[model samples]
Target chain A: MIDFIFHFTMIAAMIIFGLIAIEHKNLIYSAISLAVMSVFLGIIYFILNAPYVAVFQLVIYAGAVTVLFLAAISLVTKAKGEEED
Target chain B: MLPLNLLWWYLGAAAALYVIGLYALVSTRNMIKTVIAIEILIDGAHLNFIAFAATPTAGIDPIAHSIVITSIIIGGCIAAIALSLAINAYKHYGTIDIKKLRRLRE
Candidate 1:
């Protein structure tokens, strides 16, 4: 019974976060939401008995990837102001 | 007294999420949204692999877990490349919308 509940909860969290990541209009907000979603997914992976994946998801995704995205966003925004004709 | 048939239920749900992710990838025009949809699709694939790994099959499939890890890294690389391209497009054309980007095809 507990396993079933955990499974359902993880699915629900994934769906909710996936939707939120795409539905937001602001790109930065969407990226932040994606980071939050990734963290939640890591927790779910731990619950599912995949501790290595959970750790990888947290470190690679929430840590490295999210920072990379933010850097890209900042670079783009800076370039946007310079390109105006 | 718990239903063993619930395994099928989880599989079906994972499939449904995969389809939804595919639809989002197909229908979105924004580059960021497309990337996020791809992530969703990858997540669905991982779920399926993990689900099968949990089952009592002929043998243990550690390969699936390894594949999922490899795919996640690949997906991150793809996302980075895609975002960089999108940034370049925005810089050159001043927009990230795919519909607007078609003007450059001439």
Candidate 2:
């Protein structure tokens, strides 16, 4: 029963995060949402008995990837005078 | 004991995610949003592989996990490259909108 609940929650959270990440008007907000989504996905991986993948998801995606994206956005934002897209 | 039938539920969810990702990719004009939609599509594929690996009949396929990992890395690399190109396009064209990027085609 616990496993079932965890599975459903993970799926729901993944879907919600994906939507928010793609649909948000602001790129920063979308990037933040993607990071949050990666953290949740890490938790889901743990629930699914893949602790290695869970840690990788957290470190590589939530940590490195998010930082990379933020850096890219900053560079682009600085180069372009206008911010709204 | 959990019935194997429960796997179908996960499969359905993965399918739904794929559909949503496809819709976003088709409808969104923003380069970043399209990139994100691609990520979501990749996530759906990863979920399917992982769920299948968890099934008792599948015997926890390490091969599938390895493939998924490789694809994830490649997907990230592709996104990074695409974003850089989009930034360059913005620099040249002064706009990231797909409609405004028709100079190369003509």
Q: Best TM-score goes to which candidate?
A: 2
**What's each prediction's TM-score?**
0.84, 0.87
List candidate 1 stretches off by more than 4 Å. A77-85, B1-6, B58-60
Name the candidate that leads on lDDT. Answer: 2
**lDDT scores of the candidates, listed in order:** 0.72, 0.74
Residue-level lDDT of model 2, residues B1-106, one tens digit each, is 2247867877876786788789888877777767767767877787787778767787677787777777777767877887888778768876676755775558
Q: Give the DockQ of candidate 1.
A: 0.35
Task: Give the DockQ-based CAPRI class for model 1.
Answer: acceptable
Model 1 lDDT per residue over A2-69, tens place: 87887678667766776777777666886787788788777766655567777887887777777777
lDDT of 2 at A29: 86
Residue B75 displacement (Å), model 1: 0.9
